[model samples]
Target chain A: MQHLLATHPRRRLFQLSPPATKPSREGVFFLPSIRIGLAVLALGGLGAGSLALAQEPPAPSPERSRELIRMVRQDCGSCHGLTLRGGLGSPLLPETLRDKPPDGLKHTILLGRPGTAMPPWKTFLNEAEADWIVAQLLRGFPEESK
Target chain B: MRKALRAWCWAILAFLPLLAWSAEPTLRGTGDLGVIIERSAGRVLIVSTSSNSIISKVEGLGDLSHASVVFSRDARYAYVFGRDGGLSKVDILRGTLEKRIVQGGNSIGGAISQNGRLVAVANYEPGGLKVFTADTLEPVADIPAAYGDNKLSKVVGIADLPGDRFIYSLFDADQIWIADLRDPKAPKVEKFSNIGKAPYDGLVTPDSRHYMAGLFGEDGIALLDTWQPEQGVKRILANYGRGEEKLPVYKMPHLRGWAVAGHQVYLPAIGRHEVLVADTIHWKETARIAVRGQPVFVVARPDGRQVWVNFAFPDNGFVQVIDTLSGKIVQTLEPGKAVLHLEFTPRGETVWASARDDHKVLIYDTASFAKLAELPADSPSGIFFTSRAHRIGF
Candidate 1:
């Protein structure tokens, strides 16, 4: 855990501040180092002074990105509305998500919000994929190609 | 004078054919007419059940990703409730949008009143139920789903009752409310609190006696006897998943497609690859039929001899049919990819299914299980028929 945190000092500070205030997230910090590394990869992918500094793992291929986009459009669209407008679930539009932090959003995608209808997608998605989804969502998700 | 009169008659007769050639409207009945939601295009295909074909298409409905249709009493007009809070009344016969109103910020679905006079919409944003006059889309009343302090709960599972009443469940508040609208200006609402965890969706029995809401936060359903609101909400099929580790649910199972076959009610079990069969007489679980995937919709044929089940993603491409008499998986067929919704013809002779990914609606003969026809639609989802106009809860 010490080595993982030392390697990503900026991310460790940013990620540790939230769990300090939130008692619910305290349990999540004590998990195995592998989970912490994955969480760091997910939350710290876009939080940097420089885009190059953001620790992005191997990017998905062009073909794989399309599948991920379709899954989010149709599967997540089931509750978020096909147009990403609100339905039973809140809207995923840029306007609705602009105020929310990308780190929290990625966490929610990986480990769903407890006591809500949102379910975790960790089984279907990895840390990088969830981070990629959050990045796309923040800047208006792309429409699926016909 | 006789020659002038004959000349005038000749002129009138000459203009009659010209008027006929200019434009003549086609008259038709709406009994067999229905609407299919083109989710991606924000359009609807006005279809005919008698001929099993698409008659025409109407467009300009905003954000139809989760659109639902409820027909007016005459069945000539369909009230389409859109996700972006647009309630459009479409003239199915003329294939035109008659009236539309963006009444809310985010709306889920709606139901027409028992007498077909009022339409009530369930909303998420600024959560509340709004009633409107069926004819002109005029606002009648607004009932906010307000709970403790200033918080509001998103309302779901709205259905019309025998009297001018609408029964719905509150997801955040964990309550079920029945609004009596006999007096449209003033609705009398009866609230039952602490029903259970999140009541995601609801359905009214064919007889209009019971209203059951499927719970997503727990392993049971909240059942309400509409006739006896005083009896309170009862938890049926509680702890059905006590021992098993509930699987990750990719899609939430809908309760609207609930099936009541003979004496048993077939329900889609949440996060489990099974359908729960309960005895309607005592409201007890009699059996649990294992299925291929997590069932989304479990609908019975009109005759109740067969119940068709559709699944969520991963297993969504396949559909299974259950024999009600034997309670066994009779047949399974791969209809198409991303099969979203299903609707049986009024008499159960045929069933129409919408495959969103394939962009086609597949028709099948229920008895022979043979593919009847395939009609092109733009990312189709729900298939609603006009026969729902006369039913209690659609």
Candidate 2:
């Protein structure tokens, strides 16, 4: 169980400012799916962070894949802009990040490279969750477009 | 403990999709000084000055998505205007919603009359200006017009003057209509060709001599001398393009405003992190103060001594306070989530803000400009004070 920790409006507002948009989508501020998951992790407890990693939509099961699409729209919609079209981050669809392997995707999620707004989620997620998130990216939300 | 963590992860996986499906991106507008407004909790919020960790929130106002707030002539009452077509007259001194009257119809904004005896609300549904006796809050009249061919025919801004005096803008039609209210019961209206664009936001001077409307596409704000409608209107200044062209990489031209105060006008350049200040007296470009991120709103202090600007960038949503005289950003407050609209107390002592990212209205102390408390707001657009003039039995 997670303790109800009181959130300080000033501190987090200053430190964890949400990126307005994705710098990649032709300068439109859009958020990627993984980033949306990471933002939710920040709002959750230490266990929730791991939970986010584990629940990283696009489960091996079909039911989970449907949910992954929802996560991309809702959780990632804040800084990513609505529609998951990509704002401040690169496009997640295969066409956008083509030729990249799952390990490459996992590496980016786990050890988020420096010199970029991306943050390392190694501490927040276990290996399983990272892989699951990668699976959805590979499959793309078109499989479950609303 | 490890087992417990594992189980929790399992549970989260089950509900992750549902949770993500409902979350929405927060919207904020930077106003006058260091003020911001957004939908948080369930009320309209206002945070003034920068030093606050939390902003003061006014609850039970309305949906932030379809509502807006404006000040009375005296800046004593903040009229919370909503889409259900209602206005929540709030008393800033008493910290309460004085009264809630069904006002406006998909209206652009609300205005108080010159004598403060009556209040007028613009509604989009029926596309007309609704007048109410300020004191009784009774529907006095439904001023109709030939709305033209506007697809979104909501009255955008309103200014009350002398001689059956009132002026309002229609968004879809891109026109400004003047109504002579010398006799509140029967008024005469004359519509003019819009100087620039539609959906313009403007303010009437304290003396009610002129109305200044800010255009979105035009490079600057426009002025209409309401004193004599027959003399026609004057385009005070236009083509206020972004001054910086040296760094093609960094140069951007912007000329637009969300709100105006006294003789000073404040607006944001979408391409830059700064708000431009214009002097209504000289009617010339005055100054531009750099802000943190994306600026959406600008509002002025009651006394017009200070102007605050808020940002929209997640981290860029800090508040910047400017000394009106010098036109320089003097203090910067890191209130989370760029602000949209903010309001000041009667005495101008406290500042309240609405935050979208933080999901709450954070209040701050004006003295030290520090955060004090947080109030739950649904979608606080902008903060406004109650009408000191309304209390006199309007």
Candidate 3:
């Protein structure tokens, strides 16, 4: 059964990278030094001290991430085009979703809009997973890689 | 020596027609040909159902992730409605795309008129129904599904009715419209509003008399009798959720497949794991047969003896066949992963199922429940046979 997480925001500072250290209770496993460097590179003027205080939610295993990508590509592609350019459903492309808040998008993914054809994915995905999906959709969802 | 060589050549020429006739005497018929949509690859595999083999692959049709196909009246050409709004006319015998045009920004599906003179496309992006001539793919008429302060509604479940008419439902508008294209130049439309909430998809009965649209927001199906339009739309199986908290749907159930066996019609119940069987005489609910997962395509065989079902997302791997005679699950076969679509032979002797993850179309004997053959494909989704050319609202 899929689990749902609370809507509390967990700031994911960097991209999905293999951690050199053991995972923590908060699910932040990447090396602090590397995380800080990448965060600085990504956020431009963000300070390392503030980044250190940011918490990251537990990330899906690499295997599960692959499954999510395939699901988004094929299953979600049924309505949203395989390219995320949209068909019966609205476009999930980065350019279209960039103006939308990531949290709102995550909620939409978890709990679908009531009157629309977009069905809720919460039955098969959790809040963290939905959050990751929204982040990916904002940064351009990855292609299905076998 | 030259005269002797010329005599031998003349003898060979005299028997050339006989040799050719002996090799392939019968003319090729389009009846045994079919097309399979390879979703992610933007290509379609033209296959021969008689040999259960892939004839050729036609490529460059854009963004086929949600593509659907309709056959020409002659069954020689397949008109593919791509999600990217690319309308392509492909000649199956020649294994080539005869013509293609981006009729809209995003399209859901389309249908061919009764006379086969026009093709109507249901678009989502521009929110309208665009009709074109089948021969040249030229624009004939454009009908915008406009509602409420000049806003356009997405058109879904567009199917051709008898007498050169086209029927479709508007998703956002909760309405069904029938366009009379008897004269392709000037089309007349009749509309029925407030039928139900979110008519996701629709289908016409095998006899081409009734058009039913599946409601997404509500628990019923909005059905219209084409023969009696003055009666308006009627709701069947309303509030089927039974006052219980409904389960979240992973994928929207499809109503495009007409599964009317004898007098009973099989429809997938939204947010439920059962196929609701209803009587066609009065359109009343008869029974609900529990099945695996949310039913996607509850399609009946050509003869309407057995109804085949595939599920959504997680339960998509298994396919169940229902014996219409007894209303029981006759066989449950795990064909492969992500079985997106299924199509039966023109005679209903064999059924072909596409496994997107497995990258192959599995052919099964509908009677003996045995595997017949397998053909390779790239993320195959919808398997359409040219036999659809003769059927109404295919």
* Deviation (Å) of B57 in candidate 3: 0.7
Q: After superposition, which runs of candidate 3 have C-alpha atoms over 4 Å from their true positions? A: A1-59, B1-26
Tens digits of per-residue lDDT for model 3 on B1-394?
9999999999999999998898874568899999999988899999998899998999999879879999999999999998878999999988899999989877869999988999999988678899999999999999999998898998999999998999999999999999989987889999999999989999999999999999988999999999999999999889888898776677787887668988999999888889999999988899999999889999999889999999988899999999998999999999999998989999899999999999999999999989999999999999999989998998
Sort the predicted structures by TM-score, highest score first: 3, 1, 2
Would you list the C-alpha lDDT of every candidate in the order shown? 0.84, 0.53, 0.84
> How do the residues B1-394 of candidate 2 rate in per-residue lDDT, one tens digit apiece?
9999999999999999878876854333223222123322225444334434334445675433434555555554566665445577765434466788655433435666666667778765456788877766788777764554534454656665665466877655767887766677886678787666643455666555667665544455557777676776566546556464311111111111223466667766534566666666776667767766656556566667776667543433577787877877788887665354456655556767766445556676666787777765443445443432332211
Alpha-carbon shift of residue B214 in model 2 (angstroms):
0.9
RMSD to the hidden true structure, all candidates: 9.5, 18.3, 7.5
- Residue range B195-296, candidate 1, lDDT tens digits: 999899999999999999999989999999887878989999999998797887878887775499898999999999999999988999999999999999
Off by over 4 Å in 1: A1-59, A98-101, B1-24
- Better model by TM-score, 2 or 3? 3
Let me know the DockQ for model 3: 0.34
Docking class of 3: acceptable
Candidate 2 chain B, poorest ten consecutive residues by summed lDDT = B246-255
Q: Comparing chain B with the reference, what is the TM-score for each candidate?
A: 0.94, 0.69, 0.95
